[model samples]
Target: MDNNSILLIDPTFDPASASTCNLLVKVGLDSFSYAIINKETKQVNAVFDEQECDNGAQKFAERLKTDSYLKLPYQEVKFAIHTANTIAIPNDLYNEANLESHSQFFTESHSGNLYCQAQNHFGFTTIFTLLRAIDKTLEEFTYAKKYEQNAGLIQLAEKLDGYNLLLDFTVASFNVLFIKNQQVVFQQCYEIENTEEFNYYILLIINQLNINLQETALNLTGIINKGDEKYHCLLKYFSKADFISVDTDLNQEVLDDMPAHYYSSLLALNQCV
Candidate 1:
């Protein structure tokens, strides 16, 4: 192997499935990662990280040409867009075709080039715009919303009572999905530099939503470890805060140097697609 190679992979993993396969690519603003899974067993065949590339669209196309899986027939592709901010609204009031009007409430202002689409989840509509990180050449495949990937988890959290917070973090991005009384109340992503800033945002959401700190439940996933400062910080305020469970048959050796939990949203796309 070349010491200067940029590819990071687990040599022990042999992602081969005789049946049809699905590809989930998380096209984030700063990070790009993908996984291929068996459509029937839902087991991850392979996981790849594009080792910090700025030109994702170009890399996406080039990789397809070289990656053996891309040539497989009946292979489906799903892209989870994190660069585009997300918001959940009551379906009755949301208009999919007139999304630009709702931009006034988005953390980002709407631009002429921005396009939006809405998907329904448990009676609520998740409206989000797509990020252009990937080149238009690969637009042939259908792109699913990142919020769709979180729908199953959010609904799972709703099965219980009180306030539930789902925090999904990546290499540089973090997403917050708040559920109160079994209803999605808030969903947004935050960019953080440290634990203190992360704490600040959590508190801000709690206060803004008027959630009782003593009764709120926090379920975390993505890029966080049990003993890490990021994990402990949440524990300080919410003593009952815990990481959400993921269903995987992944070999631990393959994830030796990576945080297995951090890929929750991406893995959840298996159900989303």
Candidate 2:
């Protein structure tokens, strides 16, 4: 395994049984990860993660061509691509006929395809864009379902109650979702190059949301570790900061040597549907 990659496979996993498994893939700005889980038992069979990817879509396409595990036919294939070109509009104000115009108001200049997903419980619709290359790569799989990174976060946040701030981090980017009283209040993705930039965003969020750091529970997951600079930065203000544990039936032995929180957001993709 490469220094920047993580590979965990259950000894009992059978490639032939992949037809009964659901494949979940998360393509981040600088990372790529996938997990296989049995549909009925909800047991994770395998997980592979590669970080600091350059030209992520191309790299993923290459892996699909060569990686035996990825070539297996699964019962369902779901993709969650990370993108900053996304906007949420109130359902009452959302106009499907004007999707292009509505998306143009928020998304940056891009020649990608536009798509929309309704968050009925939240009373809004999310309009997002996916790179054409990424879309083309996904075509390799039959009837593959596509979604943005926020979809998984929303699914996980729906289960929580009261003041909660969820943070999903990557090597250079992070996704933030703030839920209060079982309702989503704010959510956005940010790219940071250093600890200072990360701290700036945290402080900005606190001021804008009027968040009581001492009272609000800060639940974190993804490429962050305890005692790291970023983690330490968060502890400075939020007294209730801690890593989130995903609620799922997984093969514990496969993850025995790794931190389960590292795959929280990725594993949450199973709850997207």
Question: Model 1, residue 195: displacement in angstroms?
Answer: 2.1
Cα lDDT of candidate 1 equals 0.61
Pick the lDDT winner: 2
Put down candidate 2 lDDT per residue, 201-260, tens digits, no spaces. Answer: 999999999998776989888889988999999988987577887776665566778887
Task: Name the weakest run of 10 consecutive residues (lDDT summed) in model 2.
Answer: 247-256
**After TM-score superposition, what is the CA distance of residue 160 in candidate 2 from its true location, in Å?**
1.4
- Global lDDT of each candidate: 0.61, 0.83
> How does model 2 score by TM-score?
0.92
The per-candidate count of clashes, in order, stands at: 4, 0
The parts of candidate 1 lying over 4 Å away from their true place are 1-19, 50-74, 96-121, 132-137, 140-161, 247-260
- Cα error, residue 118 of model 2, in Å, equals 2.8
Q: What is candidate 2's local distance difference test score?
A: 0.83
C-alpha lDDT (0 to 100) for residue 265 of candidate 2: 83
